[model samples]
Target chain A: MSEIFVKDRELVMPGDVLAKSIDILPGNGTYRDGEEIISKVIGLVKLKERFISVIPLSGKYIPKPGDRVIGVIEDVQPTFWNVNINSPYLGLLLLGEAVREYVDVTKTDISKYYDIGEIIYAKVLHVSRSGVVSLSMNDPKAKKLRGGKLVRITPYKVPRVIGREGSMIELIKEKTNCNIIVGQNGVIWIKGMNEGLATRAILLIEKESHITGLTQKVSKLLEEGDKK
Target chain B: MKKGKPERLIIDGKRLDGRDLEEFREMEAKIKVIKSADGSAMFRFGNTIAIAAVYGPRPMFPKHLQNPERAVINLRYNMVPFSTEDRVRPGVSRRSIEISKILKEAIAETVFTEEFPRTVIDIYIEMIQADGTTRCAALNAASLALADAGVPMKDLIAACSAGKVDGHIVLDVNGKEDNYGEVDMPVAMIPRENKVVLLQMDGLLTKEEFEKCLQLAKKGCMQVYKLQKECIKNTYKQIAEGDENV
Candidate 1:
């Protein structure tokens, strides 16, 4: 007999058995243990057709392929640059992936292009099973990010901050008159007239991401800031 | 100076603290007690208190120590200077080192280390008050902290102690009971799986008595597990209800 232990959107802790049947497929943050499927992290349960998974509330960022990330240059290697993408693993950006025009490495120093401590917006090209992340700046949207203040929130809350079809962030950008680029890794780059206000709004979103009607609350906050 | 042993730890079907042999100490647990830590928790069992904080699954320091197949656990167990009747030394002691290793092994069994390879998960547990079952309290706190950190785990580990007090096998021995008791044994297990990860005995026990003590300790651990589940659920409940104070 197949049995489901929890309802959709229910909060579950690690080791909590979610279902007992082979008919159901385990998703992210969940695993099959013999006859039962068990939760692997503390998060809200999500059920999709025959699949079930848990969305974690808090944890460090883990790199995945095709994720847009904002990273800081940690080291300037001769051929590749080591970028700290706010994750445990350092992202490697090879000379070929970063630059469109080839300059002889013997004649020109690679550091001149992306020096240490500089920030850049890039896409994850590949991630090895052992957690080695390779980055590429070949996309049209990818470029050096300068003259902006960075704000970090919990990585899991990144989707809430971005909202459905970028609605929440679009509202913040319009009201604060700021240019905001939100990275999938919870790093947000805000630049323009109201950087401070935008930062506060984004942080407020981070703190109350689980709450409903967050968009109304954030807009009210931004409006109040404009008055001040 | 050694204090004289009590004539009897249990009398008239009750122990010194006026509880039955199977009764466990009053327990309290809370999560997210430390803002700076990735995940943190505090646990209390009667007079004994322990707090644990977790950091990482981040890059392991000192390149050579990195494990390519799974994350490594680094645990530290410490008792504060004022935690006991007499002030304990401020640094790591031989006893603390052994306890830390024991606890790390117990907790490592639950965490899914392969999910984040080449990283390290550091757990720091501090004893705020000392009583018998201090290591058990530390284990409980560390387990809660790891779960709170969003570390993928098979199950939470709950620990409790059982001992012979005046020839009676009792669950959850206290400080005075430990001093006068003929035997002391602490047990830690994954309650859901019914798997024992750590067990230590400090004194002699007959085969039947040891079997009885193990059952009593597991029963006590189940009670602790219920408390852990309640506390974790309550924290998230407050968040779901939009209670900002949490």
Candidate 2:
């Protein structure tokens, strides 16, 4: 008989046997040992249709090719900008990819577009084997962020803050009536009226991310705020 | 006048602290104690307290040291000046260097370094209080911090110390017992795997007595393992309960 050793959302320690039987496969945060799959980190066990994976509670951001991220320009070079993507590896943003229009490199200074310590939203272009991260601002959504409160949470909690298919975030925006951008790297940019409420909601989500039925609780909190 | 060692360490099968031969000191552990680090924990074994912080699985600096095939593990074990009565120096000592190397080697056994090639894992252990068996306490704290940092590992490692004090096999020797004990052995292992990653000895013991001490140490480690698992679980449990502050 196919058996699952752990239930959904149950906390598991390293070396814990999460599942058994040859039909079951191990996914992220889990590894296969013989016929049994084991958890390799302290996390919650999530059971999919045919595979079991553990979702880690805390970790540094690991850049993937398709991830959208927020970064601060650390240095401006002739051809590229060295950006701090809040990871150990520095992200490179090429000048040619920064804007859709062409500029004379000799005449126009690159600092006008991206100065040091300025924050911007960009997409990960490529992550090399050597840990070099290439970022691109060529996407229409990518642009400079200004006059907004930026908060960082655990990168793993970004998914929870976003909720299911933008439902939770949409609720926060509607409740607070604010513009909020949640980055894949866990950096959030908030602006407009009631930015504090949006920040507080994001903080609540990050703090209570392990809880089940979190969406309902957040909805209740937002409804209460509507009265006041 | 020189202080003489105590003659009797065990009374009625209980050690000086009223603990049985196989009993461990009161222990407490908590994860995410430090907000700045990638992962951090505070562990206390009796009066001995150690806080460990873990950083990386990130990029390695000093270009030449980066490993293309696996991540590098670096450990630093240091005792604060006020941790002991004598007020030790602030910098690393010869003793600290040796402990750091051993702790690194033991923790490296459990970490899956190949998963993040060219990255580095740095573990820092600071002894806030020193009674006895500080290295063992530090090892326990470091393992918890590593797991808290979400490092891929084979298992969580637990460590304990056992020694022959006044001809009796005792678990978790205190500062006084360590000064008077005839043999001291500290051991660390992966409880689930039943694999020993660290075993070091100072002083002498007969063959039969050594075996007995090792068995007692393993039992002590198992007890510590329970606490370590609970510590990690509690951190997540609080979050699950919708607690705003964990």
Candidate 3:
């Protein structure tokens, strides 16, 4: 017995209230009070005779093309490098794509130029009609990332870190006195005054990443550090 | 170095947040925490929490695709649409696909797939909440899921990120730090082998910064791996000792 309407894209947790007396997709949800139904969870619809499927939202990551990424060199080959892009699929930094300074890439000595031990920052070129990933480091925004530490977070948090209009990051830099760069691929670089300060800032960033009022909390923490 | 709202602190050499270095968000985790699944685990880093499940040694269908000599590993990495602050569009996005592929590779490397020919292994990873370092936590969660399902893996893989910002480098940057930081490097490793299975980085860094970042990344990855290994061993021991699964 509940009474509330959950529109599409609205978040609904288990046991949350949903308005009653309204019809929903069959198999979408049950009407405990006045036809209340869960928006996404599977349940029986009150007035619908034909079965309508309601698929519960299952969390998963599905990679799309053109998404920028911070990839690690897993293995290097003569012409292409195998990169782990934090996705289920691997990316290829083909000889030509890594160093796009040339034309007719197939005729280049890609191996002598970039080999086994280097990590390049790039973006998805295509998932290919065959589902294989092709990456490019030639784009103006794409370049080789060097001399920095990396941490992995679930791809899910990339948004949170970026915050609304990049607010979260703006706050991190202002407080920790660090220069940070966030990649859509879920990699971050925090360059601060010193290792001690840098480490401290990173710790706080990881800690309050999920809190709504984190900027305030971070400011408070930074002030306390200043006092010391 | 970065700007924020007036109330937001932006001190010289101070962080956007007023906190000092060395502070970390509260962390909590549970393994085989649920009795219903073959294997399941829950882990939280700061505010991010992820749950993983493993199912397999099931049948091989379409007989043609079945391998009489090895197990077929099927992995699906998904993030719930509501796992973050803003709503996520329904269905698979590009990020999930990449994660799925990388994750499959990790499992394929470890699983004794050839031994379980004609069998299948399925791993499902879900994010309950997103804070930061979800991938590292997910890797640990994935390992637990496999172990919980009694899937044999060569090693437990642990992952983490390190980065350089402003002239110094640090480990385990959160969402905020991740966004604004200069250099970001993420890595997944087989701690036992001191070997890497996956690595990624972005942003700008000098050669010196890059080396430090790499060192720190390895250090953090190894430590996380240790914890995962212990967690797995403990869970397995509990099962052997006839302890409760939940």
Q: Pick the candidate with the highest DockQ.
A: 1
Best by lDDT: 1
lDDT of 3 at B227: 58
The digit string of per-residue lDDT tens for model 3 on A1-228 reads 323354433333222344554443324322232354332221111232333232222211224677878777778676678886655456787877776465454565555555555556787888743235788887887876666566554344566567689876676667667666666565565555633454454455543343346666666766677677
**Reference-based lDDT, residue B92, model 2:** 80
Better of 1 and 2 by lDDT: 1
Count steric clashes of candidate 1.
Answer: 0
Query: Each prediction's Cα lDDT score?
Result: 0.91, 0.88, 0.61
Q: Residues B36-64, candidate 2, lDDT per residue (tens digit)?
A: 89899999989999999999877788879
Model 2 regions lying over 4 Å from their true place: A103-108, A223-228, B1-4, B242-245
Write one digit per residue (lDDT tens) for candidate 1, span B48-67: 99999999878998979999
Sort order, TM-score high to low: 1, 2, 3
Q: Least lDDT summed over 10 consecutive residues: which range in candidate 3 chain B?
A: B1-10
- Chain A only: TM-score of every candidate? 0.96, 0.91, 0.64
Candidate 2: residue A131 lDDT (0-100): 76
Interface RMSD of 1: 1.3
Residue A140's lDDT in candidate 3: 82
**Chain B vs. true chain B: TM-score per candidate:** 0.96, 0.96, 0.84
The C-alpha RMSD in Å for every predicted model, in order, reads 1.8, 2.2, 25.3
